[model samples]
Target: MSVHHSVSTHHHGGSGAGWLALFLVLSLLLLGLVVAIATAIGDYAIGLDTVFLAVTNGLGLTGADISPIEQSVVWDLRLSRALVAALSGAGLAICGAILQALLRNPLAEPFVLGVSAGASTGAVCVIVLGIGGGGLSLSMGAFTGAFSAFALVAILSNGATSGPNHTILAGVAAAQLFNALTSYIVTTSGNAQQARDVMFWLLGSFGGVRWPDFHLLIIVVVLGLGVCLYMARALDAFTFGDEDAAALGVPVARIRLVLFALTAMITATIVSMVGAIGFVGLVVPHAARYVVGPMHLRLLPASAAIGAVFMVLADIASRVIVSQQTVPIGVVTALVGVPFFALILYRSRPQT
Candidate 1:
């Protein structure tokens, strides 16, 4: 009996150590990727020293001397854009993951929910319609679009009566209608410059992300994740159908409202910051599920981290695609996303 007990303890100890080591390795691997991608970009590649130095220098501290131009490029330009891209991408991916589990549909995402499309419509209105320029107006417009989409979906679904799956269906209906509205605006604009400007913003770029917007994205991302963490138990309950969830003490109605609002706000923030960069939402969650399984507590953070890496790498590729001008990050994402989406559809097809 004594020998058996000792062997059992030894086996369990080894298992625990193995798991702990696995977690550490994965976390470090992801961090290393984020750092490496953050440092390496096109023609004007900065070393690890310059990346940290420029960022510190911005806060009235000195670290190293690269150049005035290089400092400006790394600190003001690249750092903010990279951070924004990472945060937005990660937040959106978490949103997507939540939605997938909530609605129990693999097809669910920002685009499918109509939040992204509605936000796109509002952004196009500002850029093409010339409401206002380059400041609060743009962010406000994008938020308006995002909220409008969520509101329309909610209202149409009769939120009091409809379930989460029902709500997703309502979103599909709303998205189709908003997409039509946006398309109409593009065709009706009739001015080449207006149309081109609208089109470009829709295609997305992190090139000129400003300090103000970057801060806002950070706040929103952090807040959204906070809400997500608090409600993770409800979300996990949501995984097992509504009836099962309710039996397990899940507040179905409240959790639905919280997640919907959180995701909409997050979607708006991302759209405002990066002009509707795609794929990160649809792909990241699926990848995270493979890594960490379906538990929201582990899944959300992992999805966010991996999603951040995904966008930064894509942004890097966008900048490197040409010698003179960088391609819009949106275009790179779309090209990649559409094919990946097709693969997903094919793989998930019912094996009838």
Candidate 2:
């Protein structure tokens, strides 16, 4: 009896560790896949060898011979966009996972709380009304707008008592209001060319992302991931509903507010940089949950990794799907997301 008990205890002890190791391995492999694909598939089409040489030389690892043009294309254009996509995807996915858990709603996503709409409105204001200067100024505007929308949602939802349905309704109202404001600014004030530019941004495009943008995105994603991981235990508590969480001494109200603010900040930062890429936060978390289950500790990192892979692949498809022109990243994400959304809905529907 003692030997049997020992064997069973040992097996149980290793199971969690085993699953975690598997997730980490899978995430690394996905990261590798995205890096390879992003480096290799572009207009100029640099070989894998040249791509590595350019990267290593840039990193001061080794002095490898490569042409200036190839170096510029790989280092400046392709690599920057790829890095931004990965970082943005990871940030969005983490936000979604946190939101879904906190709200106790599987459908909760980063933008569902109206952050993206607010960010878009802010960016449009900068572009059309000249509220702020170009570049950094636009980012600031978007950030401000995002938080403002979230503030409204919080008020309407009535803090901890609001529930998921109330929050979603409040979000919808905020989104419509901001979206309309964005349309008015673009149409009434801007010229045709400016309007076109704004439209592209509103729909999401990474065509103009540079090294500077990548730097900011990397900082935000790394910090957001750290914060989420730190709150992983609290997040798991939230999955069990407010009463249960409070019973566990989780301080449900304070923690929910903090997580909401963090998600808003992360979402706004990405939207300011990349023009509101959609469906990533909604779809990636669900897929990650399906693969890794609902525990936030394992779920957060897995979702980030899967989200990064999804965005990188989407960006690649946007570039190649049409020979001369690039499809908006948001459109690609939506096309992919709708199917997943349907499946989730179907699975979640109550049976007779």
- Judged by lDDT, which candidate is best? 2
Off by over 4 Å in 2: 1-13, 133-136
- Model 1 residue runs over 4 Å out of place are 1-40, 59-61, 132-136, 350-352
lDDT string, candidate 1, 32-129, tens digits: 56645665565777777667777778877875667898788777777777778778778879889988878878777877788988888888778767
Summarize candidate 2's per-residue lDDT along 1-352 as a digit string, tens digits: 4322432343324676688678878777877777767877877788988988888877789888889998888888888888888888899999999989887888889888998999999988988888855654878999999999999899989976667678888988989999999998888999998899888898788888889998888887888888889888778777767777777678888888888898998999899988998889988999998877777777898899899988888998888899878899999999999999999999999998
- The positional error of residue 275 in candidate 1, measured at the CA in angstroms, is 1.1
What is the Cα-based lDDT of residue 256 in candidate 1?
A: 84
Model 1, position 17, has a per-residue lDDT of: 47
